[model samples]
Target: MTKNELGIQAMQKGNFEEAAKYFSEAIEENPTDPLLYVNFGNLLAALNDHERAIRFFEKAIEIDSNTATAYYGAGTVSYNKNDFVKAKDFFEKAMKNGLESSDLFFMFGMTFIQLEQPRLALPYLQRAIELNEKDIDARFQYGLCLAQFGQMEEAKKELSIVVEQEPNHSDAYYNLGVAYAYEENIDKALSMFNKALDIQPDHLLAGNAKKLIEEAINR
Candidate 1:
């Protein structure tokens, strides 16, 4: 196998030092290969060596501005650092460079969410779900974006599917409760809140919502 391939295998086996050595050798042998830099950047990113990782990604971009994965690597590093604006920029560049993976869409969606633009987040989140329907986190976030836009019925539909797919999803149940409450379905709302509380006993929002419902019923 190629040194880069060996490096990837070592990385997957959690042998970071070995992987780094292999990647270093691979880069030395093929310095013009943008993929090598992207791989090394990914390894460094996994190790939380953000500075070196970014440098590697930049090097890959310098070699080939159209290297989408290099932009994605830089975006992920920026995202991890909570630099949402820079992350968004890099993700957009990745997209412009033809990176259309579900993961890229998901991160782009999340960056918009972090930037407090749920409207901007909705389409990307929806695209992520379309690309990978089994991605529960993307579905959950899509439901949240729907609810944020006051699309309660749509939110309920998505959240309900989440609970069915992952029964122990407390946050999904809680969101369902909120959607039902918005629709004035008190009993169903209470049932959902109870389910959330059962899954996560310390769920403060569910507990508070349950109390408020009870107080309203008592009055």
Candidate 2:
């Protein structure tokens, strides 16, 4: 088998040392193939070698200048390194180069959140939700972002949809309860928190919310 094929096989089998050796040999054999750099970069990233992974991705971009996946790989490494500004820069470049996926939008949104630009993140997350309404994580985070921006009514609507979709989702229940509380719907907030606790008996937030409800009731 060709070194490239062997590298791919080792990568799929989770044999990182073998994969890296084969990929390195492939790079020496065919230094011009962007796929070689990308594969090497991917394995390095999986190994948590973000700095080296970024270099490989940049090398791929230098070789093929137009491949969107290289930009995405760079962006992902930057994001994983918690460099939101750089991640955003690369993500925008990737998108401009024809990268399109709900996950991409969601990743950008998350990076924006890290940058404390949650308002700016909202549209991207909303698009992600539109692209894949079934993704509970996207909906749940989108709802929380809305509430963060004081868009309580809109947040309630999104959270309500999530609870409908997965009645036992503890985090959804907890976030939805927070949305209700923001809207001053105290009864609904208490009910949702109670349900969250029922789903996850050890959930600290749910237990705390339940205590708050009891205190309010006693008041």
Candidate 3:
């Protein structure tokens, strides 16, 4: 079997080590192919070997400077290292090239959040929701961003939708409980905590909230 085909098959099975080996052998056979570096970088990145991953990513960029995947890989590792400025720069470079998607935009928003730039996170997250309204995790993060920026009402709206769509989402209920508590709706807050506990009995926040609610009731 062709090395590239074997690499693809190995990757599909999550055997990244074998995939990398096959890709390396394929690279020896076809050194000019940029896709080989892409495959190798992806496998190394999956293994969390950031230094080697960046090397392969750099090779991909050298072969074709316009490949967005190379920039994205470098950006992701920088973000993983908590270098938000570098991460932002690489993500922007990727977007300027050919990378545009809800997931990428959401990642940019998340990087802004790490940089304590909630305002900047808003537009990216809003764009993500606009692009794909069905991304529940993105919706949750948007609500969290709103909450961080003191937009409690808006945050409640988004989180409430999560609860409505997925009644068993403990985090959604917990977030709603927090919002209600902030709004001075103690009864509603307690009810949300109860719902959260019902959904995930071992949830730390729900367990703590239940104790607090029972204490309040006893008082």
What RMSD does model 3 have? 2.4
Pick by TM-score: which candidate is best?
A: 1
Predicted structure 1, TM vs. truth: 0.97
Q: Candidate 1 lDDT, tens digit per residue, 91-170?
A: 99999999999999999999999999989999998999999998899999999999988999899989988988999999
Q: Per-model C-alpha lDDT, please?
A: 0.97, 0.89, 0.87
lDDT of 2 at 191: 86
What TM-score does structure 3 among the candidates reach?
A: 0.86
lDDT, residue 35, model 2: 82
Query: Which segments of candidate 1 are over 4 A away from where they belong?
Result: none
**Tens digit of lDDT per residue, candidate 3, span 1-219?**
899889989998998878988998999999988878977887888889989988998998999998887888888888987889999998898889978888788888899989989889898888888998877777888998888778899999999888777778899999888888888898999888889988898989878976887788799
- TM-score for each of the candidates: 0.97, 0.87, 0.86
As for TM-score, the candidate ahead, 2 or 3, is: 2
Model 3 residue pairs with clashes = none
